[model samples]
Every structure is written in structure tokens, then in C-alpha cells.
Target: MSWRPQYRSSKFRHVYGKAATKENCFDGVPITRGVQDNNFCAVNPRFLAVVTECAGGGAFLVLSVHHTGKVDPHHPRVSGHRGNVLDVKWNPFDDYCIASCSEDATVKVWEIPPHGLLKNMTVALKELQGHSRRVGLIEWHPTAKNILFSTAYDYKVMIWNLDCPEQVIKNPVRTISHHTDVVLSMSFNVDASLMATTCKDRKIRLLEPRSGTLLQEANCKTHKASKVLILDNVNKLLTSGTSRWNDRQIALWDLDDLSVPLLEENLDGSSGFLFPFYDPDTHMLYLAGKGDGNIRYYEISSEKPYIHYLTEYRSNLPQKGMGVMPKRGLDVSSCEVFRFYKLVTIKALIEPLSMIVPRRSESYQEDIYPMTAGNKAALTADEWLTGIDRGPVLMSLKPGHPTGESDGECEKDQAYIRDRLIAKNGGKTDSNGVAGNGGTTVSNGQDFLLCSPPKTENELRVKFYKQQDEIRRLVDLLHQRDVRIKQLELEINNMKNSQQNSLEHF
Candidate 1:
């Protein structure tokens, strides 16, 4: 028989996505039915944020990632936007901080309570309102601490430095005016030194993110309705778009030379937009269509035919939007390398799919899960503004639930919390917030440490008691206030009755 070349060998070839069971899925979530091109979901290790439909104004629901099953209809929400929310992105360095853009022509940054939301939040930490038109997309900087990028219907890209310590920010730090039509998608390179965007004008352009300088514009004319993300590992740019024949296509181009694409492949003639996500550690690229149930993955290599097609994960429910859990948030014990939170609008459910590498050994698989990008940021907003570039901080997956934060960082956070609690209580505090012991250990049910989870039963009891005491005190105060108000109203009514009697006698 004539020699036939075989497919390339890859460890990730056998990796498959294992979806969660029905009981573990989020249910009764009123997902937004808006036709916006952007995904209405954003997730991190702490919380899952979903854009929900409400009557009076725009609102989105935030649930603890650990809390699955049925969500209460009266659950707390962040409903500050006056219009439909277009996109939501969590801060890489801070798990409790999230940024959202809305059709109200403003971008708002909200800080969720560390444990989770307890009541409806109607205010935001900062509000940026420079866009004359509705803001459609918002993305956080990969390496910097407080850098955010947003695009609006006004054909302008705006950058905001959220490091303001005194007051809320009203305008973006810089704005890039390049596209003639609407800007469809925007992405930053590895260290966020450069940016790539696909505009509605059917063109791809590369630019300097910090300075708002246009670097290069791709001249391809056939691919339209595109979304772009850079594979910084291979120094290549990938774009998913539609051909003139209405066929979906994916193209890979070199970063240095965007004059032409390095490779292009036509996908099926699906009308939905293709959202591309790349995991650098696994060298895997996943494309999930907007209105489809299939998630196609490929292996990107450095050799010829760089983009290698792998098997796809198929389902029956079409997804409205999707959110990816951070690499550090993955379940390393289950050999779970990647996780996607898929939003199924028809059922109003959020199902999680875990991409697993089938390994016989129960021990940690070091090869497959290397030191991936950690949750800690590499540079601050000031450092990035001063032209300093750094890659993402690296962390070992050996720690099953590594928070990607250094011990010193975690210690600093704990110390700050203890100081704040002490100030609020007007005394030195202990771990249980009582005025006693010398050593202070601020504990919570949701441990924010960088190691494996510890026993939280005691912490939960302590928290429950503290909350109970506060509620009791507040209730007593409310009763006293109500009694005084009743006494005043009775006095006023008696005076009115006496005055009416006097008037009748006259």
C-alpha cells in the first residue's frame, strides 16, 4: 500500500468536554433575550454574572459559583444600568470586581461583596460616560490591574485607567477614533501592548492600546462580520468571519505582517457569529457559535498547517452566551483543564461543561496542566501607563484551588480586612471579631487564601452569629423608631380632632 501520512499526535487529542449533571446546573435564570452580538455573561472563581431581563431598567444577576440549582426570582441583582447591558468582564486581579457596559452610553464598574450579593445593588463604584452612542463591548487588560477597554456604536474605542482613588471617573483616559462604521470586536495581545479589532466596515486593524495609535490595517476584503483574538503563544492573529458566499471562515495571520492571512479555512454556512477562545497552556482553540449547540476545538501548533481540527462537543440546547472560568479556578483534581459556563436561554439555565483529559492515574497530571496563567496581575495601571509590559503571573496547578495569589498578597488582604473590622467595631478584634485575643485571623466561609480550602464550619458559625447580632440590633432600633412615629401620629390626630370640635362650636 502507498504510504499515507497519519494525523499529528497530541496529548489533547483525546480530551473531551464532560458536562455537569442536571442537578448541578443553574435553573430559573431569566436570561436576557436581547439580540446583541456580545455575550451577556462573565464568570470568575467567585461569582457567575448573567445579564437578566427586567421591566423597569437594565439589570444583571450575580450568583456564587458554588451555588448551583434553582435561583430565586427575588435574588439580589446589580440593576444600575438604564439600558440593556451589552457585556460584563471580571477583573483578573480582583475576583470581586466586575465591569459592565450598557446601551445607556456608559460603562460602570461594580464591586461585589466578597461573599456575594446580599441585596439589590443600585449604585456602581465608577461610571464612565464618554461615548456618544451606546457602548457595546468591554474588556479588561490581561496583565494590568485596573485597565479597561470599551467600544461603542460611535465607531470609537476608549481606554480607561480605573486607578482613581479619590472620586469616580467620568471619562476615559484615551479614545481611538479610527473605524468609519461600528466596531464589532476588540482584543489585546499577550501583554496588552497591542490591540486587534474587527470593525463593521469589514476590515481588521491593529493598534497600540495605551497610546491609541493605529499600527496596521489588514487589506482583506472577502471576510466580513468578523471577531478577532490573538494567539500570543504562536505570535499569530486569528479571526472568525463570514465569506462573501455566506460561509463562516477562520483565518490565521502573522502579527508582524497583517497584509495577508497566513491560512484561511471555510466553516459551514452558519449565520451565527463564531466566538473564539484560546487556551495557551493546552494549545487549544475553541469556537462556539452564537446561536448553535456545537463547540468545535482545534489544536494550534508551530508546524505547517498550524491549526489542527479536533473533535467537537455537541449539545441540543443553543447557547445565548458563554463564560469561561479562569485557569486557576479549574478543578485540577478532576483533571479539568478548562471550564465553560454555557447559557441556554430557552430553559433559562446555565450549564457548566468541563473539558477533561482522560487519565488513568488519580494523581495530578503535571504535563497536561503546567504552570498556567495565575489570577494575580503582573503590572499595575500606573506601570502600564508608564510603558511597562509584563506577562501574566504564573502559578502551579499542584495546589488544587490555588487562588493565584502569593502568600504575602493574601496576608495583606487579611490584614487590611482585620484593620477595617477593628475600626468599625471601635476596638481590637480577634478572628471571631470579638474584643479578646492578640492574634487576629479574619476568617470567612469563602476563603480567599492561596492554598487548599480549609474547614469552614467554625467560620460559618462565627459569621452567622455576627449577622444575627446585627440583625437583632437593627430590628430593635426599627421597633423603637416605629413606636415613636406612632406616638407622633396619634398626637397629631388628636390635635386635628380638637380643632374640628372647636370649629363646629364656633
Candidate 2:
């Protein structure tokens, strides 16, 4: 059979256009079917790694081999975890060594080859285990490969020394358990001196990596929040996310005094649970919401906050979500675009020879001249007929024709048969009226067709009306709830006043 067209839709063509039409194509190469279930991705100075949760309960790492856009099929495959691998990072100075943390309560160090191998190119160099529960995050020390940090559900963060890979240290160098809930995210400042952890308790804490001393704490009231905390070179801290009261806000904090925010501004719309990204180079913040399916960009400045849309790309599927917007690569000479494709299930034929019939018994009787028949051979006649020596068959199937047929005669015969078949099939012609193999084309001279626009202005008007109605209904409900809350508070105050008068009388 001919190759089935897997991608022929207009959308695919629009995304990946002809090589000549660079403007029509996406900003960069589209990475189809690269990411697994994991939503987190990271890129170092040289390599790009996509960390995905595997189907077998572990994580799969697909890395780009070089700084360029080439992917090596034999990159690496580090396995040996019982849970999802949440995070993976390579040492800034050494690209060959990588650290991965898993929900299996273990962290592993892997030394990957720079090129291909006969076997799997990736191998785990060492495994570190200390957390009692699933590890949430893993980050390498900014300055040294000898140290790494990991936080887990066990309510403690651990630091490890890679100098001794075989031994398991029971106690971490420093442990922070101040958060009342699970630590969902963590990051280290550019200078490895300070580490920040955001927990489910709606608090962001800054701690010294060496001493585990809490330098400062800021309360971010958002429930189920993932905080992106950045420490500027001058020691100023910038934190942004949803508030605990369901307010969408980005707050700036002075590390010296964390009790009061230096600046706070509410975002006009709610940002769904996906974590926001902060670009230090451009001083721009990007936030995406799970419900709206839009990414909003904001500029950071000393004056009043300014936010605008850079561009919006729609998600292809529902429920399936986008992960953190990872830095495509270190080179920013041109804007890069990366597309993700989820896995698809496929069915295939396993057995190919189940329908063939055996040769007739008359042929089997002729074979009795050289083979024993009344001697009762254990092998059946059909098996014997089918079991001709494979060497001769393979040789006969090779190019240049079997020993019995001449090459010239075979070629002539094949041409004659093909012409006869074509004639019998009426010399099937395509839309161009050329007598050739079957193919379809548009009836018109045009090579392609444009998509039809929306039906009518009335339909568009209705859609807009429906959206406005939804917004109005939501506002009315919120106002009613607020009024009820105020009435309840007034009644409770009146009751307290009456109780106080009775106590005074007594």
C-alpha cells in the first residue's frame, strides 16, 4: 500500500509551510511528539531538555543534542524510578551530567554521552534518596556541581554532595520545614546564596541555602499557587501570582522588610493555576490561564503597571493543557516557536501469513519419489512442502531474475503485463485529463481552495450577545453575594452590641 497521509489538513500546512515560504511557517521548527505527560521543561546554556512523566510511572527525558535545532535519536534514556519525574536539570558548567528528581522519593545523577552508542546512550550514574514522600522539585546549585537541592512532600528540603555518590546521607545539610503544607515549587537566585520555596500554605519563603535560615517570608494568599520569585542583583525581590482572596495580582517586595509589599497591582483577569513566567532580560511577565486559554504579557517598570498582549495562540485540544513556556534556546537572534504533540494510540497487524493454503496431495505424492511416505515420517507433507531451504529462496528473490528466467525476458514480461492491466482499467486519468496513475485535483484551474468565512452578521451578533449576557450574569451574582455578606455582618454586630448592654446591666 502507498504511504497514508498523516498530516494533510490546512492547519498543518499553515503551521508548517513550504520551505520557500518562511514567513508562512511558524517562528521556528515545530517539535511534534516531543513532550510526554510532564508539564515542565528547562533549557540550559547549551542543551534543551523536555521532562515528561512516562506511562510506566517514571519520567522520560528528550533532549536536543546541540545548541542548534537538531535532535539526536540516541540522546539518552535514564530510567529506574517508580514515580513521575517532576524535574531535570543539567549542570551549567558541565553539560554531560544531569540531575533528575522523581515522585518516587529519589534523585539521580546521570552521565550522558555526547554522541550515539550501540546500546542506549543514557545511563544513571548515581541515585540519591532521602525524602519520605514524592519529590516536588530539583535544582542544581548555581556555582558548583558538588551541591544540589530538592524539595518533597515530606516537608523538608535536602542538599546533597555529589563527591560521594554511593553513600546515602540520612540528614540533609540543611532542612526547612516551616511551611504548613506541601512545597509545590522552588527556585534558586542567580547567585546560589538564596533559595526560595513556595508552598500550598500560600507563603513564599526566602532561605539561606547553606544554613537553612529563613531570611524573609511573604504571604501570597492564592490557594494552590506556584510562585516565581526572582531576586534582583541589588537584593530586591519580585513575586507575582494569584492572591489567597482570589485576587490576581503581582507584588514586589523589599527583601529587607517582607511584612509590607513595596508595590502591588491587581491583574484585570484571573490567571488559571498555570505558573506565570518572568523574563529578566526583557523585563516582561507572561501569565496563562487554564480557563481562558490565553497568555497575557505585562511589562515591568517603576511607574504604574502596564500590560498588553504580545500574541495569542489557541490551544489545539481541550482539557489537555500547555506547560511552562520554556526558553527555546540560548540564542535569541530570531524568535523561536515550538509545538507539542501528545501520544496517539495505533493498531497494527501482528501475523501476516494466516490465510495461505497448502499445496495439493498429488504434489505431495510426487514428492514420495525421493521422500519416505510409508516410513511414516514425523513431519507432515504440508510442512515439508513449505520448508524448502531458505537460502535458495532468498537468493532467488534477489535482483537480476531467478536462475530459470532471463533478465531481459523478465523485464519485457513485466512491461507487457503492466500495459495490459492499464489498458484493461481504461487508462484511468486524473482531473487534468492526463492518462496516468489515479490522482485528484480541483475542477477549477486553481491549485487550492480557501476556507469559507462565517455564515452571516446575524450569527456573529448573537454570539457577541451571548458572551455579554454571560458576563452580566456573573457580575450580578457577585454583587448579590457581596450584599448578603454585608447584611450578615451588620446583624452579627447588632447582636454583639445587645449582649454587651445586658452584661453592663448585670
TM-score per candidate, chains pooled: 0.83, 0.52
Clashing pairs in 1: none
lDDT of 1 by residue, 335-424 (tens): 998899999999999999999998888887889888877778898989999999999888887753444555654555455445544554
Clashing pairs in 2: 221-243, 221-244, 222-243, 222-244
Q: Distance (Å) between predicted and true CA of 280, model 2?
A: 2.7
lDDT of 2 by residue, 1-506 (tens): 99885642221122210111222211222222322222344444223454543456565444432223332343334555677667777654344567777778888777654321213323467778788988877776654435678888788888776666365545555577777787767776654556777776778788876667888887754332466566444345666566556666666666677777766666655544544555543445555554343445544544343232343434322212232222322111112222222111121000000101123332212211111111112232233223321111111211122222224433443343344334534787446443345321122222111122236534433443443343334334555776799999999999999999999999
Off by over 4 Å in 2: 1-39, 45-47, 53-55, 65-76, 116-123, 165-171, 221-225, 244-248, 266-271, 289-293, 302-329, 335-506
Q: In candidate 1, residue 361 scores what lDDT?
A: 89
Q: State the C-alpha lDDT per candidate.
A: 0.83, 0.48
